[model samples]
Target: MSGTTLLINLAGSIALLLWGTHMISSALLRGFGTQLRQWLGQNLTNRWMALACGIGITGVLQSSTAVSLMATSFTAAGTLSLAPALAVMLGANIGSTLVVQLLSFDISIVTPLVLLVGFIVFRLRDDSRFESLGCALIGLGLMLLALRMLGATLGDVEGSAIFQLLMRSLDGELLLALLVATVLAWVCHSSVAVVLLIASLAGAGLLSPSTSMALVLGVNIGGALPSLVNAGSSVARRLPLGNFLVRLSGVLMLLPWVPLLAQPQLLGQLPPALLVVGVHSAFSLVLALLFIGLTAPLAALLTRLLPEPERVVDPGMPLYLDESGLEVANIGLANAAREALRMADMLSSMLSRVLQLLRTSEQANADEVRRIDQSLDLLSAAIRAYLADIGKEGISDQDADRSQEILMFVINLEHAGDILSTSLAQLAARRLRRGEHFSAFELGTLYPLHREVLESLSLAVTVFLREDLPTAHQLVNRKEVVRRLEAMASREHFRTLREDKSAWAESGDIFQRLLRDYRRVHHHIAALAYPALERAGERDINGGLVGDGLADAPDTIDRKEPEQCAS
Candidate 1:
């Protein structure tokens, strides 16, 4: 092949490597992002666990940059402490070299077989996760095939004058060589690809071991660029910045010794490709060992540098809805889910305050109810706007369903807030203004029903967060219990009005209105569970009929009540 053709082939091989790495990373995230995130959260009790989590997660993702982004996002959300996050980065750096180590071996023979199996699995599987797993397998196969092709192309020029001239030029200028490799890595958005390319070149005798080692140093530093540039918040930037600094320090410490270590008689006894891979792995391990102890102080410095900004009171802003995440569907959906959770929290506060207002006559409590009501309105509006801006083109059909679920869930909560604030708040205020004291029997009837509604609201929020099907079905059943309580309470109130006018004069109107509104609130809360129930096919979403899947389903209760008590 001509020099130009060989060069083109090499370039194509590099692109292939990058494409393969992207496939692996994106697939891993789509398949296991939530589970990995939960595992990381559960294990990050200390620096050591954090380090282990980072290593294990990065090894699975096959991309340290992805792990860094995950850590940085958690830090920004305040779900993770900075010190442990920094430790995770240290371990992630070490985990990234595993790809290089695997690629250095002679696994090219299995490429076709892997690709065949991947294609079959992808073609046969209907689930997104399974399909994504197939995609990952295909990507790995492509990477191996690209490595073989790259090696063949580079070997063709082993004795050429151009190759000799290029090597001679890079032989003395190690820093210049490092710059080239670093730029390549940054542009590719993958240090694994860059390291693999350098190893292939070294194995083919197109580049010496010393040159490859210098390039590996560049790869380490360049690997951090993507995370740093992508981080929109200071909290997100701190973890990646700390990671880069650790790598920079390690590189500086090893710079003077590169030449000494590169001498064939000293440390080059292994094959050229193996030496390059070994050096990359050793450098990462060194970074982890040297910096693990200093993570706390390092985190402190980072915290001092990027101190959490005083939270601005933007009631209209969506706290977790990051626009940058919209480019990646899973991440954007996760952000939307978190924002939905925040809304649920506000709704929970509103419910608690409503319950408080029912039991107390404090002016401060009434004011808090009004204040939280307004906040809920602002938060709900912000959530809708945030969801509107998220593009649907990239997300899977399942994610589209999730987005709809969040939208509907938030809308239900907002409606429930309006009920509590407008209807329930008004009745409570009227009762307090009248200076009325309820009889012991009346108070007894209201308290139990109120507590049950509160419990349903809490459980509904749980169903929203967890999508627990069994609990969702139970929540639907609880809706029936609430209906009975409302009916019974209304019937007792009417009997009191007929039999004991003096007692009725004190709390009758307020008590009736409160029961009606509380039942309305329960209806809204129970509505949140219907989506889950519908997804499980336990209920027909449109007709409100229970599905045949239930072997011993409860008989559907008639929910109609007396006209005066109707919500």
Candidate 2:
């Protein structure tokens, strides 16, 4: 064959190989990413089991790189822990070796047959996954068939004088042989291809068995380049994964004599391809066994060394909703999601308490308010972190909607806490500075109403959680009455504010603060009514279904001049 023809075939074969690998990887990801994540998270009840699962998963996938990348993505998203990911990384190493072994077999004899069948299925698009899978198989078959042709092409040129001269220089220098092999394999992003090239060269008599085996060592070392480089750019805890690569590859090459047994006479009779696969897998497994047990100590060290990574507010944490973590058990999956929701609720509750504390005139109250505000902020941060984790998990459409809604609700709750703490609390403080307290009669009129309004809000939340349609319906009817009563109480207080200018000057700020907070809390409660209605399959309460019963509501709070004091 001409040089041009050889080059074209090689390029075409290489492209098809890369493309096929990509398609298969994506299908595996799309079909199983979330299930995979959930399984990793909740299913790894023990370290040994985690290691086993990791190995099994990676072995099945045929790409340790894929497993590592998936684990890195999960760690960054906050869904996966460093230990579990490390466990998978170990398994992935073993899994990746499986690919080389498969390639080593004489599957090429049947390659054309598989390719023919694959093409027939590929054209059938009704089952898109099947079609994709068919195309992938065809691509694989073509790459294999290309290897045979390339093997023949090289064999034709092997006994030539020029080839003999070239072989003399490369044969003796193991490092040189290793370097060339590494570069070529790195270029292809495939150690399997590297091993194939080695096998073909040895088979064609282009290179001696010893030299070909030396190149296999280089192939394994080269495999680490992509993953090691990627690890540098990964999250802090995942640096160890890259470290695993550097250690594995470096150790194998440094101690090659023990493992490679790279003798030309020995290499000549053995299946060089199978040797490549075995050595590569064993090298990784050795590394995993040596290091996987050290996962916890390593994690602790990384934590101690790296410090806490700075978190940003933008692209929130990815939940373990991806295919990696979710394959364990259905109950475990639901538990993780619900825990995320519960965290959100806890944040909302804590934030509410902080806001309530902020609404005070006493200096003592102010101190407590500030402390609670800081606590609320911390809770918000924690909830946000948990949300990032849940986002990484595989979610059903309904779960996705619920997850987003819960996140949004927490954000709103956080802001509400901020407003109350900063604005309402300050007003309360200023009123107390004047030494006036809630008037006895004013308390009598407003306190019971406030209690009743809060009780109603409590009832609404309970009904929503329980999915009680009747209770929700009844709560809808009472909201109007609560609004009327709130308005009436506001008037009675306003009348008191009007009666005594001196009193207004003294406690005006406190009175206004209380009224504003009372109204704002009521508004939040009112807003929750809709969610309750939604739970019950009712129309939006804010829409016409509730009618104009509360239509005369003051769009804005009435800030009119005070009148005669009722108190």
Candidate 3:
């Protein structure tokens, strides 16, 4: 083969390999990404367990980069700590070497057969799981095929002058070899692919033992680059950077003596292909053993290197709306739900302040309520914009419903915040200014109503998070009780007004408005439960209660029959 053709062939084969690796990662993630993330979250209790989890997940996914990205995001989200994440990265590095070990053996004969089966399954089965399985199979077949092509392209030019010169430059200068290998792995985004390529070259006698070992070390360092580049926070970058530091330290410490080991005595006694993979695995094993016991100090050093930012006193932004998850529908939905939960929590805070304002008026509490309302507005806008950015093409039907539910929940929460900031907050400010305190009876009624609304908001948020059906039913029923309480409170206020004109003039208007605003806020809270109720097929016609097909009383807190209100 001519030099130009050989270069083109090699480039094309590498591209094919990259495409295959991407296909495998994306397919596995689409099918089981939630479970994998859950496993990482549930299992990473300590360094060793985290290391084991990292190894297992990487082994199953066949991509350390994927594992690293996950650990980084979790740490960014505060779900996984830096120390455990670092342990996982070490395990992932070791897990990645398994791919190289498997690829070293001859399995090219099954490539065509796997391709045929994958094509048939992908064409015939329309299920997402089966489709993903087929895509993974096809990707595996293509990866094997790309490896074969790479070997063929290099084998043809083994004795060419250009090839000899290229070999000579890397042979004498291990540092240059290390740089080349690092760049190749970084660009390809797969250390396994790059290491396998090195092993192939070593196997074909186009590279020496020491040169291959240097390249392997470079590949390990390069493997850490993608996660670092992709990380958006200090917490996310710390673990990957630590992993890179460990690998770099190991490689540099061993660099001077790699030539000594390659002197046909220590490591050179093994076959060339085994030597490459064995060295790769051994280096990772050594790193794992050394760093596994030092995770505490390592974590402390990383903390000192990358300190956490000071916590905001009054956070006004979305905490979990990660843009990276937009391409993955389930992950994006989970992020949206979390942001929605934050909004609900803010609403609860506002309601609590409203209750406190009713009992004891304070300028600071009123000011805090206003600030929280502003925060709620900002968060609502962020979540709406985030949901808009998520592409609808890939979202499953359930996720589409979830997206709509999140949008509706945030909208209702925003409306509820407006009720507090405008209606309730102004009333409290007026009361504080005029030195008007609610009557003892009025306070008694308002306290229960406020407490119920706060509790319902919490439950609605829970339903949004977990979609718990029974809890949702109880929330819907509680709305009716709040209505009755409001109506009874209104009746007592009017009865007092009739009995004494003094009470009516002193507290009548504030009493009526308070009841109206609290009931309105409750309405918004109750509305949040509707989506869950509808999904469970338990929505009532007029009452909006979650029960079998019985029409409810007209949805009104307007004074019920006096006995019914009392009930």
Best by TM-score: 3
Give the Å error, residue 187, model 1.
2.9
Candidate ranking (lDDT, best to worst): 3, 1, 2
Superposed model 1: Cα runs more than 4 Å off: 1-34, 46-82, 109-164, 196-212, 262-265, 268-274, 308-567
lDDT of 3 by residue, 151-254 (tens): 67656766578766786679868999999889877875678777877776788787899998998989998998988887787877888888889889888888
The CA lDDT of each predicted structure is: 0.75, 0.56, 0.79
Q: Which of the numbered candidates is closest to the native, going by highest lDDT? A: 3
Residue 451 local lDDT, model 2: 53
lDDT of 1 at 285: 92
* TM-score sort, best first: 3, 2, 1
After superposition, which runs of candidate 3 have C-alpha atoms over 4 Å from their true positions? 1-34, 44-81, 109-160, 196-208, 268-274, 308-567
Give per-residue CA lDDT, model 1, range 229-336, as digits (tens).
888978788988898899889989997788889887977677888888888899999888888899999989998998777876755467777555666777787887
At residue 372, candidate 3 shows an lDDT of 94
Locate the minimum summed-lDDT window of 10 residues in model 1: 558-567
Count clashing residue pairs per candidate: 0, 44, 0
